[model samples]
Target: MQRFLIALCCLLCSLPAAAWNGAGHRLVAVIAWQQLSAPTRAFVSAALADHPDHSRWVERAGGHGAAAIFAEAATWADSIRNDPRYYDAGRGEPTPPIGGRFDSRRQRHWHYVDLDATGRPVKGELDRQVERLSRLLGTADAPDEITYALPWLAHLVADLHQPLHVGRSDDDGGTRFTVENPFSKRLPFLSLHAYWDELPGPSSLRGRRLQREAARLLSEHRPPAQGDVDLWREESRHLHASAYPHQAGSLLPIVDEAFQRQARATAERRLSEAGYRLGRLLEARLRHRVSRETP
Candidate 1:
């Protein structure tokens, strides 16, 4: 019994750490938080109030507290860095110098494909993760516990919106190719995978201004309809075949242009959709909770 308890303790302790890593995941959280509506924001705020560490940081940061929240989200990504299954194996470890192509087979099977595809989880593992999150949130009655789950859910959903996160199994969704950043000459800081991760918009924007920019883009572009999702899937497949192959060649300018255009469009649509979806979920949940508490 003592041995079992020790093992269980270790496993339990490792679980949170395992979930944390992947900047991609944290980036989703940052985007989701930025895109939240008023009610959704309130729900997130109430949920976060239960978390002393996160709450304390927010409180200390004051009105611009959301910035701190995104910083925390970024930090959380580091915690889950060791979980290999969460990322594409093709990227060959998260560090750098990634080379190779994405597996076509994996792309078909995973719902998390890329800018073109939406909603398919690679190998159906994402559904199980969502189920786990649901269970966790179900048992969590406190605001803090709820807040913890909120970010996780929000972030994961956003990650799914990122076409690269759903990448192919073999090439790990373009994780192998390395490219130089057009904006920076400091180093050859480019990878097919990294390019996808940072796509569509400049990372320089922050706070409400960033949120406003995303909102404006969404207003201008609009979300793809259900029919559009199919088109995206087809386009993603095409991109996988054509773009992934030439990603490493002397086609830097062409590749950069393609990535920028796709990233911008995807970012606007997904960010807008995340806000709408999160608002719907938060409203339903909050209404029920309020009704239950009412005299």
Candidate 2:
């Protein structure tokens, strides 16, 4: 019995390292739902009650870590390339498939696809994916399956909002450049790709600390208009153009008050936008479905 207990402990300890780092995003989702207009919250609550297991996906996806859930869902969503917007315009190519090995190269390409194209195609794909997910939610036989898939959908929507995640084919959307940590003084740890994903703000501040800061920022900025999508696209374009490895040297010099303030502001605004958009999508789906289901 003692040996068995030790084995279980070892297994549990190993699980966290491989998990996807999605807590920040998940927090955004939860908070976003909570902050919704009462009717919107009611719609989500009804949908979840109708499919109790779907609600649990939020916790499960966060548990297995971010990468695992993302890979699994991306794979599923990639299987059906129904969204026309993801297709390459001139070449007529489908977006590169999702859910295989994490090719930093291909992932970078996906980022560009999101940035350059209209959100319509991506939104269309999400709509279909959510339909499939909602169907799966209606049936309770596969709780674990639903757990992996529902959160996967949630995470991917958030990914679409990350400007870097919408990067183009060049520079693998910033993955090609290796740079040192200006603040840590450690060996260069991340590519521009990673810096966008993880290093936008303070590492020490996490969970509620991060969520509260993000919420505050969102409140201050007000909700974005559709035109803001273009603004986001242009911002990514400029960041991509400004790439110079030595510029990383300047990262730490400004890491004090100025950097922290700027980073927090940017992260907060972007993340809040992501949450708000996600809420709108969820609310729309729930309203449509509930109307259909009613007699």
Candidate 3:
């Protein structure tokens, strides 16, 4: 069992430095889907169908239905990290993808907002981008623009719920610090950010298993109250300090059974809240659009 735990830890450590692994993002989408009204779901389906990568998402889901496609699309923002089609801004000039309202540059800074110990923004556009994208999705008249904004908005909302993303820049949102896990003797230390990112479970989780887990999360955790991005960011920021494992006078914090247990619970709660909050946001945005168009 120890060897297996070590292997799992090593595998999780190797995952990309996204807020949550693919499974977590997808699970959030699935849980959100459960809360969405039928009209909101239909709006989502229509908007996604027009996405440039819609076909690719369908293919990846093995031609699954709308729910699977929606779950797949939740990871699209992170998916572009390795995609050559989109280059990081200021890094290089690649011929932009030839399509409607598409900015081919990967907006890496859109993922998180790093605040200083005093709560001043040092970098990252996550808060600003979420508000902008949410507004754009709600008010945009162009189909293509809606397509372009939907995935980004969905993704950023989930990212905003991750405590580290809204946390301090002191340790680069916990990525700079390494925590030792006693469960793994061979590979005892891993980045604190990576440890939190993997708490939602494996990156390959999908399909029925994903749905079941999401359902279980919903059952176990109550939905968060309706709040704007600012409120959400504040909540995450407050939780950030507590995310670090505490050890008296020790530079390195050790992740023992108790710490892991609490961390896992916190991570799961965040995931659940992310899903419910996203659902409410989408429903409001889409329903407003419907009301405007009904005239």
| Model 1 Cα RMSD, 1 decimal | 13.4
Alpha carbon deviation, residue 116, candidate 3 (Å): 0.9
> What local lDDT does model 3 show for residue 156?
83
| Residue-by-residue lDDT tens digits, candidate 3, 1-295 | 6645754565456543577888888888888888887777887888888788898889877655788899889899999898988888678877577354577877889988999988888989999999998898778888788888878877888888888888588877777767776665545667777777777888899777887899999999987897898998998899876788876213357787878898889889988998998888888887877555433
Sorted by TM-score (best first), the order is 3, 1, 2
Error of 1 at 278 (Å): 3.1
TM-score of each: 0.58, 0.52, 0.89
lDDT of each: 0.45, 0.43, 0.81
Instruction: Score residue 201 of candidate 1 by CA lDDT.
Output: 47
Q: Candidate 1, residues 1-295: lDDT per residue as tens digits? A: 6534543443333221122123333343444455445555555565555443455346433455663464354333333344342354465443332122211111112224423244343443433444455455556676444655654555454444545545554545555444444554432344455566554445434456544664565467543342222343343444454344244423342255575566556555654554444434444445555445323
Q: For each candidate, C-alpha RMSD in Å?
A: 13.4, 12.6, 4.1
Candidate 2, residues 249-268: lDDT per residue as tens digits?
43321134455355545655
Question: Which candidate has the top score in lDDT?
Answer: 3
Q: Lowest summed-lDDT stretch of 10 residues in model 1? A: 101-110
lDDT of 2: 0.43
